[model samples]
Target: MDMDGGWCSLEEIGPLSKLRRLTLHGLEDVSASSLAETARISSKEHLEYLELHWSSSGCMELRDEIEKQQQQEVVEEVLEKLCPPPRIHELHIKGYFGRTLPNWMMVVEACACKSLSILCLAYLPCCTKLADGLCRLPSLERLVIADAPAIKSIGSEFQASSSSSTVDGGVTESTSAAFPNLKYLSLVGLCEWEDWEWEEQTVDVTAGAMAMHALERLEIMKGKLSCLPPGLANNKRHALRELNLVELSNLTSVENFPSIVELIVCDCPKLKRISGLSRLHKIGIGRCPSVEVLQGVPSLHSIELEDGTIERLPGYLPCVNPKFLKLTCSKELHGSIISGSSSEWEKISHITKVVIYDIEDSDEG
Candidate 1:
């Protein structure tokens, strides 16, 4: 039912105990009682997916600071009462303007939604950072955080606190294991995010705690992430296979993907070096002018470059033996590559297939 002005109350949905999925929109007018009654319904246990969104119109034209603050408080209260029942496998919260999330989204033990696997949080413009408990969920496999402009860091709060029972050989009892079961993660459009702090106690993979042990693919876009999470980058046994970094301005180097098979770097102007990717098979670089070398990547078979400045090939090119090579360069660079006198010609001559395009052609075509 649409949550527009007084159309349906939570009391009406109380008997739908078997609900498997639900989307509630136009939450601006929903009262705190309506939301509380909705959460109290028995159907919460059967809900597998839930999406909550507030109306854009309700928050768009407000110019009064006091009135806006009052509205924010009401929104927060309504959201607090709208908590989804435990065991939900998927949840999406969008356009929430509250400075903090409700307890249901962050309290791990109390909510006990151990079956929760996929969580997507978007357009949360006021939340400074993710809820600490979100990273400690036992079954969370996919997490997406997007468009949170105030978030500046992801720190120890993202990890499970150390437990009291001491284990053998100097390991902590609880061992702050964060995202232990996560396989896919994406951080997008967090314009203010700058730091992803590494909690050494939780991230030290060699200490026998498997942190982010199940991650396979990671995508970061439109953020200030200068480097990867140290726990993820340093873990040699991590299962990551695909890594994509797009529009990260401060990132200078790409390193330590020991088993990654696919790598994509785009629009990172400060990027310079890529090393220690031993199992990579495909590589794509675009709009990164400072990147100069790619080494220790012997398994690379496909390479694509767009608007890059490197004139020579990798020092280990004889071992790379790429099956496909594509380059889109400036007119001068394109001329130099095709010229028999340029060293770039000899380096890529052995490739079985090569595709070339000038910068203008690439853009126009």
Candidate 2:
């Protein structure tokens, strides 16, 4: 309960009824029957977690688009009277200027909440989509869509819907999976998120392999993503195991991610290719210079190259040798890795720990 605009009058608190966490920010002077009694105190079934914020400085003084669609219909009528609490598990809707949302946030069994796992839809500018029943929530594990810059697309209605089963007494129809137990997925600072297709015949094929079957750690930063979500492209990820792509400059491609095992690609400069990640053990490539090549990672032990634009390396290794090789790069690639070249010390000679620094001694250490 954090309304800064006009303190008090969510029907004056009263029956918190064992409230279990709630945050309502500077609601630009709430009132629509006190936001419908704060949506009936969030339909308390012992509320689980709900955050609703408004007033991005009173929506930057609504620079007229008919007064910002009349303050986006009064912030979608106070987020449809601030409803959400059918056992809400976690829901955060920040700085809303609602373009749409209501209808119990797109029917999670009509806002039963199904114990929602975590859903954060941040700084909505004019919410283009998302929150339209958010893939029908089946215990969403973790989802973060930040700083919405007028979403570009996450189409296919974000899947998850078909339900009906009874077999043996006859009924059968079960097929729905979208964020089906999602596991840590973050998309930050969406600068007009490019696309996230998903609509391959409205799921089937066992609901498209139960959709991202329990995804395991995936992060995309500063987005404008050019690709991703063909079930995480190439070989369709099974249980993504840690993958990070930063500064997505209209990402080009990183091909397969067959159960990735720790991989980071930063400052994607029109990413070219990183080949089929064959269970990488740990690899970090920064300021990518259109990644020329890095054969099929064979459970690579460890490698962290930043800058210098990878002069050379990655011929085979990964038969369990390398334990760590962090190259900061350039003083002529640290003098071609120590001795100008001897096949770069036979290509990092079975590395058990090689940290070639310098790039101004790694920024003056």
Clashes of each: 2, 1
Task: Give the clashing residue pairs of candidate 2, or none.
Answer: 106-133
Error of 2 at 205 (Å): 5.6
Q: Which residue pairs show collisions in model 1? A: 17-43, 163-174
Q: Report how far residue 192 has shifted in candidate 1, in Å.
A: 1.0
Cα deviation of 263, candidate 2, in Å: 5.9
User: How would you encode candidate 1's per-residue C-alpha lDDT over 214-273 as one tens digit per residue?
Assistant: 789989998787887656675455588999999998898888778799999999988888
Name the top TM-score candidate: 1
Q: How many pairs in model 1 have backbone atoms within 3 A of each other, for residues 3 or more apart or on separate chains, i.e. clashes?
A: 2
